[model samples]
Target: MKSFKRKAKIYLPLLMVGAVIGLLFTNCSKQGFDAAVAEIQKGDDPFLGYAWHINNTGQSVFATSGSGVVGFDLNMLKAWTSGLSGSGLKIVVSDDGIQDAHEDLKDNFLYGVSINYHLSTPTGANNAPPNSVDDNHGTAVAGLIAAVGGNGVGTKGIAYKSKLIAYNLLSSNVAQLDERIGQQVTGGYDIYNMSWGSSQNNLPVPVAVWGTSLVAGVTNGRAGKGSIYVKSAGNDFIVKCHNSTTTYCVGNANFDPDNNMPYTLMTGALNSMGEVASYSSPGANLWVSSFGGEFGDDYPAMITTDRSGCSAGYAQTLNSGKVEFERGSDGNSKCNYTTTFNGTSAAAPVLAGAIALILEANPNLTWRDVKYILAKTAVQVSPNMSNVTRHPFYNYPGDASKNVRLPTGAIWENAWVTNAAGFKFHNWFGFGRVNVDAAVALARNYSSPYTAGPSVIGFLMNSSPSPNAIPDYDAAGISSTLSVGTSLRIEAVQVQINISHNNIADLGIELISPSGTKSMIVNMRNSLTGIAGFDNDIFLSNAFFHERSNGTWTLKVYDGASNDITGTLNSWGVKIIGTP
Candidate 1:
């Protein structure tokens, strides 16, 4: 409706794999190894082909200011972040509650909540105790979600316009965390990163009430104006098949991917092999996978910041300094301390951070809108792969229906994008790999049926206005400007005929816009509201009107059903008869 999006260069995070370094060399080499440019690897990883997308694409469009996280492409991240920063968004961090703010957070945090109970007496702010040890996790989470870029320091974030409002929500006890969330319905954080989910071994409620609270936090976030809660789909790593809420750590108590719930997103971890990590949780409810390769499964180059002392389990960070994760921080003989780590917990926040970047770019997006953009925007690793591959036994009469083909990946005879072996939507790989270009394109190309004008709007009644409507119209018929805007929907219904019109029933009404752009108003199936009585009228059902953006409009009604089809307009009444 309005071009208000912050200029954003959404850069995806550098790919981290716990797999063999040799594989990294191989994957990296695949770029130089491209003889014909295989589609399997779009190779948008800039390091291989073009210079970092930051310098190549959107440097001019955006101000190159700050950065933030988002579940999208790095090049797009470069574009998305720079643009948003140009739009004036700062950064904030929520490192282990109020007082224990870390370096990545300190001055960056925003205080959207002002509850007095948590405020420090002297400072007039909620200066909670500086539980430093556990602050690393939150700081790391902060960095990934909204790290400032181009400072010659750390990596940049996905969105530059996003500002952080860090409020640590981890509790020493799950119940307390849940209660606190209940109190902080607005959850303070525009993006709540719950990196830690209790093991099913520990069950305090019939179902995980904490997970419920997290979802509730997202709901409240929507109410709070603009917020998106991203939670790690837990580290259980099981094939979560059914959707149920049983007594124990219920198996199917999750959203169905085939039937996604209204709100909330659950992600899985993609190991370097591009296969679902054995440790990654699975089910029809799974949305997408983030990089969380097991130690040595992909990039062993990562450093998980240890926040053993803070209350909120962790805030993801760059494994460094006073806030570094020591080799022996676990206080146990079995801590498995190494740079190589694998857990859905590690991947979820990265995805969540990306969501934050998206929200920053488009603050008007509702949770549903956000979900739609993300899903619709994701580019399947292999756009032609399938999810399930049925063997010959499962084949009926040995025929496959294109309409009923399995999802993007995992198909019987993979023939969509041939030569590009492998199904992308396998049970393991949700919907191919997350392609940044595809996702952002989806967002940019999105055009909802938002009404552009108000009542009494003029329907120019012409394909392209001319001397017939306006004098001296055109030398090049393809391009012309009439009124220059489509609004004030010319309200009414008229008859429309089919393309197969060797018959006399060829009748219809043209919905000409103020700009002379025409959309035909025809009779069709009347399904729902604001549409029951106007079956044959110009319908604005999908018209997602921008609150107060639609301007005045006009309509040119005509007779098409059973008449000469030329005279039902009220232009004179709307203002055409010399002030009559």
Candidate 2:
């Protein structure tokens, strides 16, 4: 569970439980090595059969109560046989400290390159290790990224041979947060996996400095080819509306302002059945999704390396009130592994490992090229999701007089939008779950003109109207348009909004591209329920990827609730970031 904070200052040092994995195929067997590619050696890794994320065949992932859908996997066996195992790449697990001595990770853990921060030394230092029993998230994260393969003891990682490093920035104080960001840049690593995120409330979180750092990483890091940054979309799909409300509310991935940036890949989580993981935060910023599974006891979850012994990690021998899998039983008597590690936290690392394989296939490909490849090859899962609208506080028994009702005929969430570029995108699954084999095949022959350098041309087109009054409880909300003239093959779209409302969560925001593609940027009845309105806050959407940025972009703001709260759209604008 991620620690939630509501403070004036920002501190992102907490763990958020989130969502991927897979191992060997029982029937899809290959004999010996291929002639052209490197030898496909899975070694004697004993638990390979239990890794469904690597190759799914309806296996239960070590749980007896549930089963996964066949063919809902990363499809890595083909890529692995073709010699794309992410060798010679450095991946940084930017979360809690990693157990460098863990048997599955020691061979690949890059010594003296990882950093750990303490109050005594705010600048951070080498020798990163778990600070306490609570600091155990990164070890599981590392195992998912590049736990050593073959040596034959535990489960294998997605990129089993890739170099691994860690940064214990979550344990650092808020005073050194800037130093932590700087450290993220100082390390010349190829990919950074951030499996944690801040709260889901909408209180206008600042991102100017963070965006600057992300730009620096993609522009100057990794010898100018650009380092890839993968982040979790969040895991707060079902949460309390507020401190006082008992009803559960939906958490949008866009609530966290950091996820809206174009420089990082925001990933969502899916279950073993190829469905949206129940807790995955949905939003328009998600680039792709991966299996994060469910709790490992009754349902299938992730299988990864835990703390070395029973008494230290999630799987303890003597632990009481825990499931059989987490208590050193059910073929895990040695207490060396855990099957309950699921979340977007799990999903981010899984995607990171896939990115490592992509880089290995074509190291010359730029970050933008990698993103484009993913967008091109992603597979859309659960294609039947429909448009949804919510009315959380409607006819509240506690305060019926202050009842809330969503405006009629207003869609709070869009089903699936196929842009003019022929790319399909969904808020729950992004472009779709990652297809490792397809992505690798594309990477082998992929090249982008943007590889010379990032020509991320950004232009803002603001609305001419000063302020438009919004109607209360009306589906016909204020509509503003920004006619973009710059010719850019759009990669990401950001909408800067300035509004004043008593309950911003009651406001549903939508962006319509000139190509007639509609994206719900902010869902109604979100975590921002009781807050005032936006003040130049920026919202992002990846649904417009590869579209032409040369037409009118419409922005619609709806007062979805009947709470008698009036608001005004002070000013709004569109900022397009992409290559010309």
Candidate 3:
């Protein structure tokens, strides 16, 4: 939430300014944009128009598909014509595996730097190519990031000219995965696109090494300019809540602890109609959002490279539930491309590609500069949505006679709040949907104030006040206050809690900044709702970014479920990363 001091409310005007600057700087005219669009319309790729993420004009992507909302795209046409196609940048796709020779992706693949960790030596020509249908993920993910463009090929990528390095970390050991995120054997990559997450929710993974790597990458990778790490906020919004057939959503972006890291830029998803995707998980940790269409069967989805040929992949001839394009019943007889790739998986790479374009615009920009540009230029969607609603856990099972409703009767979701720094944030969409055109324009003129960036071992303060008993099914939660003496601007905040409870999901945890900005880092009724509580588990939030850290900070934990069992707030600590 670093204050850009720019008028972010004038979003459309900012976009126009970006377009004008891009056109003027590249010496391209509006006719150039039109000519590029006309070339695509004349069938340069035969499917570019269907790729609504690049430029949405409400055209159906497949035979039986419905159209998306007009103008709800990445607005990349101007950026593309302005000579920003992510040239000279390198991206790492850490996932299952990739079809390196796929028609749409082969041209951009970086052979020498890629790795196949499943192999004995873990490096060579066979750099983790797809071995089965299950291994088709990385190929699609790669296509979203760097599939070749305007080559009279299949579809265009967001960063068409960016080089890609593939890694089969999904099939490798955890140590190798940790290395990929941290200091790699070949360690000069620019952006790391991670579309994977932990299956275990509300449980701590061994992220200490990965967390250290993330800090190092942002501070020291890419020749000291810092490497950008883009990750997918999980795709579990529609999952069933704990111990119930009812499909109540309990997914939060912070559930996967990897996303909680300040260095990790987590992105949520937007569907074809320019709304939050039904399956996109929501939390305070999300930085921004990008397109991840609905299932391609009924609506348009991402069109990207799949496994080679019809022998395997989602586009295989015999694959079930595929759309017209994927089944090869249409023009895709080779079955090389699939139109069914969708999720935060797709959304994350979209942001990564956008980051690539920003870097290409100005490679001198630091990691923090890139983040500031994005936050400054993001477009707020669903602006009219109410900021307060009846709390989701207000009606949880609790003895009416013994437990009373929480006094603060509302929960904040889908609502925008302008922090003290004049930066607006929302739980559903952090800053808002990324405006690539505006972001690129800002990046071109941006300079980093944080020349050295935040240190790896951030400033930490702990509060181990005497344990307090949390009321059962009551709104009156126990609160602990800590007075801080450190004076520094905030970049991100992390809170580690040790709580003892029968059912963890029944609890809600929030951090109230000295500025009175209340951020619910962990929500109630998550996947761990019926599980035992955590001890010393850490959660992070970006809601207080750019705010001062020299005031009183408060921690509140409450139980929402009606049960005889109660929980104890054992101890909690805080860590803040930013400038002094």
Candidate 4:
């Protein structure tokens, strides 16, 4: 383990001075303008200009003073000014296209590294110009992670000093995504931020082909250490739907399986108040949460760079249904910026920026090392009893509610689970929100558990084939058990289930370890109405982190829907991968 005493010695003075400056600025409310000007003159960060979440104390003074923003309490900006900025790291944003020429993003842009895969013959250069309708999304995402800081211009980025490479992979073509992943691996990019995914209710199940390609990329990317993939959990939780004639809402975040892979770091969104964003997805796959503001009369969304002229973003749409261009002091049309960027799209980049800082603090840390430090240091917040429910679609009556019961008299609580060895986890918020100070500190001293030898040799522990039929609308369905013969420190758990049903979304699968810790592998995706059930589809979970592999592990497959949708547990198996 790294020495905390040595780390404290280097950063204590900087933290103390920053706190004093923060307090001084906080007390002199009237001099806020003068303080900002002085900071600009001293080449300090000017994030306080438009970022209201920094000091948002209440709804009344939201844009002025509060402790709710993502990086405020963590002192991430102070770390940036103290020379922990991502100077040598490379970050790539795989999205529609980025406006590399935006005043806030131009300086850190990596020339010749960007590619436009959307073109007929995918070119090497990023020719997607600014002010186009499709250019704003990537530009905003890039700005959150690598927009230039302390430049006396627009808002600052998380790792403003990091180099950015933009790839225009606009299509959902699996080949295009695989090609981009290949480029990131071969091109030596350290981190890849993906803030977009498939739309809600559209193929609400995981695609096996996509999952295989993603696993390969992450396992072999970054010259063997593996490139860090930061992905958004999605924004489908806000949609409302009904089964047949019953009314219900779709908040089961598990519907979007693109982020359920083990190698990727899945990020969810939190509002300024540190509460889960209404639209952010929830599931066991979520690894961490970050600030992606709420949209309403009281809550404001994220503020980032936008395309120039009068042809970009929601600001233009809100301005009399046309793109409206803001003019500078020189009376010339200028690039527009908006505070309407919300959802997991904005949250993923926030974590990516923080990851750059971690890499900058300790470049030797591996991809798994980063995940470990994040899981260990993330701060738990907002312990509401919302997650403890019968089912995600608990509002619906009849078939949905009959099979979605939790035992007989059991009540669910959104509680934090700390394993025997001390790793923490939460379903809705993952390991809670990211704490830059703690993550960076841990990263600096992190010693990889697999460093003693080659990466921990992962072997399949046991497998149980279930050929039994699962009854429809039955709370007590078919289960298979696998007994472990050897003791092992579990890291990743892979479950493959095969079933045949009209609506696979009505199935809820759970993995009960020998210790009785239940992991919801597949939740009831009400939006998925396809007849194709889980046909040898693999689902990975790290929720069982730090558990001892012994005794009999149970796999329960319950069919939660009625109305002629029935399935058989054709065959199910579990692969335990870890060190012994």
Candidate 5:
């Protein structure tokens, strides 16, 4: 029996946490953060609220609808925001509430609701949240998509001139199940972000609100219907995010059933260093990873925001220049800047924000086009970064193997000698990181009939982001640069990111600049690739800013959220082009 247990432990690490039964990952805040707490942002501190700090700022977050935005390095996000200003073209941001009310959000917002959140009863508003208790998730998500542009007081987002919408979903049980079908079919939303999760314990009365609604929405959206669904990577240590309740069919290997719309895109998360987050489930059904903070020794790798008015106000007291962390769950709050997290809830917004930037570049893009560009234009990463890298919060606690980088070629079979750095395509990095340069180049060089922006390969995001800010790269720090009209066109901005498994979308996505300011760009729901396009087409774009400083470009992937997008990627190619 002992031998069997030993073998199970050894082989099961690569599989789902279920194979060996896993514990809940880090408590969302203090896992490996004993070393980086003093660097917390004290609200409104220039360059202080980067991705390492945790502040929800009363916004409706993208993935899984959580609170608090982890802060990033200030300088890093500057590069991310600099490229946002442009003329003739207005950037459009996606939101859950359909109404972005952040202090910095832009005026116009693109609204759309997820099918699941729609009311099933014939006599109801079909509100996504199904309550009057201000589900900040929707507002939080809108804030990430498009906060005020050119606003220097707060953090910056991926796009400057954009709008948002509540895109309501229903959490309460309604009377008519047909309402579910009607909401999905009628809501003319461009992209819908779904950060919530399910395992069956909630016992949803089988209605139009099933997983199929997402597929239908994506199908219609990608087909130029201005409808797409950005789902979160289920927060599970299993194959299909199958927690104790929900059971995913894709894990069955024989999941070859049919559906109305198989066009859903899911996302996952990575750490501050661009590697998969420790708590990040697996790369199985994941799609991409966005910067979720992870900078400085004094702070943890996190995506920061102004969470002063959020539900977990206790954890976000220091946001927007206030002290709130001092309090415990009992209500007493503590005031500090640095914070930590672990889940897909954090990663989804990042990808969504990137897409918003791409949309800014070309307003005529469709959901299908967005998927195409993502998969086809991505950077390759180390092989076992996904399988070998254990979830720091749950696995390898006190185990020496957790910190060790695997030998070259150990992850993939017959890996190239140059791959000694451990870079490859797999669950760890779905086609590697998103190449902002390639994507822009494609938009500039190509003239495809399907897509608009120079045949742009994909959205914003770079390959490598770090060095400017060692250890944790809150925002891109020294890793990236933004050229309004100096280098790349203002309408053309991109970030470095890893499109990993479509899971862990709860982690927040952030952007920081040189001055130490920051912003939450996309939610975990937005980080997934609607399709699995090709990999490597360097011709997308690359810039050499003659008047730019040498900054380390970094893309932090959040570790949260997931959906059937894993299967979606395998079936469809990542497309870029769609208006939210």
Candidate 6:
């Protein structure tokens, strides 16, 4: 089934039962875990005394009792902690900077290894400036992954014992990003979590130089086993705001090129209701979803460590410049913790923590193996109702004169595609919500597909090329085909397109595999109004995961705009990577 145009929503009746049972077991196990954690001495960590997300026992010391409405299912965590707490695994947070000296984080910090790439004389120290506004971001991200657990002080991280290395790349340029990533990979870090990116719909498409660097890192890093890179799918979502009678619109996620990189595990965000977060970006590029909380008073946000001194952090904003604190019976601020961390930023680290657990369970698994296991074991959550509307600036030729109204009904439903091998995939929720327990168990007993022999090694199995003119203002676009004679298990597909146009943002591109699985390479990016067009830019897609590579593959390019600006498809090609 074509992903975008379909209305198939797979609703699992068993999920409701499973959620109920999961909650019951979580509550029952909380008491034991609580007592176990209380025995450890936590110097000043207040939230760990009674955090709802960590304990799930309705005994939170804070004002908001999130109970069951604001936490990742702790059953998985409880099961994971029983056997492992990521004892030896390492995760590097590449962001603004991490407050390594924060009480909750000092224990797990890997000093002398973290680096500040933006510095002229890059140092091992990765702590943010003492009182900088941007310093809290990395601190919050680090706390989510490896803040010390059972300390009786602060909240516990997903993998509280995992070692953390911070790399400050906030002010570094694109070239520096690759350089620092290289350092992490070579430093034996098991996983890297990047929770920041340029705005998804911003103008001027990014070049593929950084993408090439990422490909090289995955191919050569970690002693050739490859380092795991977990990235946050952008938070840009096309929303309509009606002020009185006038309406203002925004951008979509399909244009986020960073998430489209196949080498990284791009994650989206889910709220307390297990639904897509209002700001979480959506597209075929999303690999998975994780709990990152939601907006509004009814839905509690995620709670994590903030910058020291409470000078700049999420809680400060909530309390009107004062640090958010747990109130005692006397109505006085007692323990300090911030419950304002949200967005895909928070979701990425959650997934990174899960990866740390997986690595701790089975460190021998290759990077691809981790991806395979995550795709296999994720819990398929409910569908996210989406509305696909025409770009306001570039309506289809025939519909140019019609008034553009907000789209209604569900235009995109998260549907499952069961491949011949029984592997299920989805464009929206990815394989689904992360299940740490299931993933850990699977990892302990998993075997790599590439371990069999050379026959299973991923290689370029086929290719098709085309250099022709693409039709503008026409639904019937240009197409090029490539034929494969031998059957092969497909792992990834790469498409390269070169074009020249007055306004390249008006273009829409797609690729159809031999099995008729259509992957949308580029949706009309109305936000990119630059006159420059694509020049041999490469786009990657995993939509046809596991499909046999032995048929005619077609690349289609078209411009849906009726405006004076038009473009010609200079050249296009398809490369299928897999084992024969």
Which candidate ranks first by lDDT, i.e. highest?
2
**What's the residue-level lDDT of 17 in candidate 6?**
16
lDDT of 6: 0.60
Write the residue-wise lDDT of candidate 2 on 42-128 in tens digits. Answer: 677766666778876666655555667767889778888887778999998877678898988899988767776753553335557
Q: What are the per-residue Cα lDDT tens digits for candidate 6 across 317-429?
A: 24542223522221123323566566778888888988888888887887888888888787776533332444432242344432432223212222455554555556556
Q: Which residue ranges in model 6 land beyond 4 Å of their true spot?
A: 1-75, 118-120, 126-131, 171-186, 202-216, 239-257, 296-298, 321-336, 383-416, 419-421, 452-479, 485-487, 530-532, 558-566
How accurate locally, in lDDT, is each candidate? Answer: 0.33, 0.76, 0.71, 0.61, 0.33, 0.60
CA RMSD of each candidate after superposition: 18.5, 5.5, 9.1, 9.8, 16.9, 8.8
Candidate that beats the other on TM-score, 4 or 6, i.e. the better one: 4
Among these predictions, the greatest TM-score belongs to 2
Please give each candidate's TM-score. Answer: 0.46, 0.89, 0.86, 0.79, 0.48, 0.76
By the TM-score metric, which is better: model 3 or model 6?
A: 3
| Candidate 1 positional error at 355, Å | 2.1
lDDT of 5: 0.33
Model 6 weakest 10-residue run by lDDT: 1-10
- Cα deviation at 417, candidate 3, in Å, is 1.8
Across residues 1-580, which tens digit of lDDT does each residue of candidate 5 receive? Answer: 0000101111111122322322222223332232232343333433223333122222111112122223211112332434643222222222223323334543444323223244453222322332333333444444444444444444444433544444343322222234433353344454455544432111122234544555455445434435545544534333323242222211210011111122444554544433444334333223444433322122233433323343332134333422223222212222111233234444555556566555555556666556556555655444433332222222333544323222222221111111111222343333444544455445444454342322222343333333222112111212243322112111112332333333422222333322222222222322222323212211100111011211322223332222322211111111122221
After superposing candidate 4 on the true structure, give the runs of residues whose Cα lies further than 4 Å from its correct spot: 1-47, 52-78, 118-123, 126-132, 171-186, 200-223, 240-257, 317-335, 384-387, 390-414, 452-478, 530-532, 561-566
Q: For candidate 3, write residues 411-456 as lDDT tens digits.
A: 5343677777777888778888889889888887776667554742
Q: Across residues 1-580, which tens digit of lDDT does each residue of candidate 4 receive?
A: 0001111201000001112111212222434434433443325544334453333332212233322432332336555656887888888887657777778888989887676665665545755443245345778788888878778767777787998887755422324433454453334468988876654343344555656665566567666667788888776553434333233334444454565567788888876655666666666678888767655223446667776554564445334421122222112234356555666878888889899999889887777778878888888766443345464434333444423444332233345666655666676678777888778877777777754311232233333355467777766777777776655676667776777776776677878878777777666544555547766666666677767777788888777665556777776666776656
Winner on TM-score between 1 and 4 is 4
